[model samples]
Target: MPAPRKYPDELPERAVREVRTTSRPIAHVAKDLGIHKEALRGWVRQAEADAGERDDRLTAAEHEELKQLREEAAELRRANEILKAASAPFAQELDRPRTRPTRRSTA
Candidate 1:
């Protein structure tokens, strides 16, 4: 599970908007908003990526899709392991020889 966010959702949006529109330094904006400069910078970068302004990072939608795909792949691997374990006994049974016992005649 993800850790809880330190700042509210609106704060990042407002900070990013300020950085974009006002052309002010990130540190200054962060100081004014009481946010960590690095966090605000990351938010700006992510917003740019989401807006198609940057290509170096995954957009929010792409990130979410990638996360979901990873979870699905993990689930498939777990299910495969379960099936392999369940079939082991049947595989061993198939490997054994089927021989009939001979009856002995009394003299």
Candidate 2:
């Protein structure tokens, strides 16, 4: 059986920076820090994901512009539908009204 594990009471703020500054393998870092290699890999993955999310958030103005454009398109479509409905009755009215034909006999 593997021996019981011991962990440091506190992790320094600069621990990651210090580890990255050196050219040592991650396994060496994990072993020297009394932690698991998989845990360090998990942290790296999470950090990359967070950076990607931050980059998306950085385009706040562009995102807002896109949202506004979508809303304007929806409004224009509704206006077009209302205009079509209003014009339909008038188009029918034009067809229904017709002058009666008149005929005059010539002498």
Highest-scoring model, TM-score: 1
Flag regions of model 1 displaced more than 4 Å: 100-107
**Worst lDDT 10-window in candidate 1:** 5-14
What are the per-residue Cα lDDT tens digits for candidate 1 across 7-106?
9989999999999999999999999999899999999999999999999999999999999999999999999999999999999999999999998999
lDDT of 2 by residue, 1-107 (tens): 54653444244223444455785676777778767877665444444444564452435456579988999999999999999999999999988969888977797
Please, what is the TM-score per model? 0.89, 0.39
Residue 98 miss distance in model 2 (angstroms): 5.2
Q: Rate the local accuracy (lDDT) of all candidates.
A: 0.97, 0.64
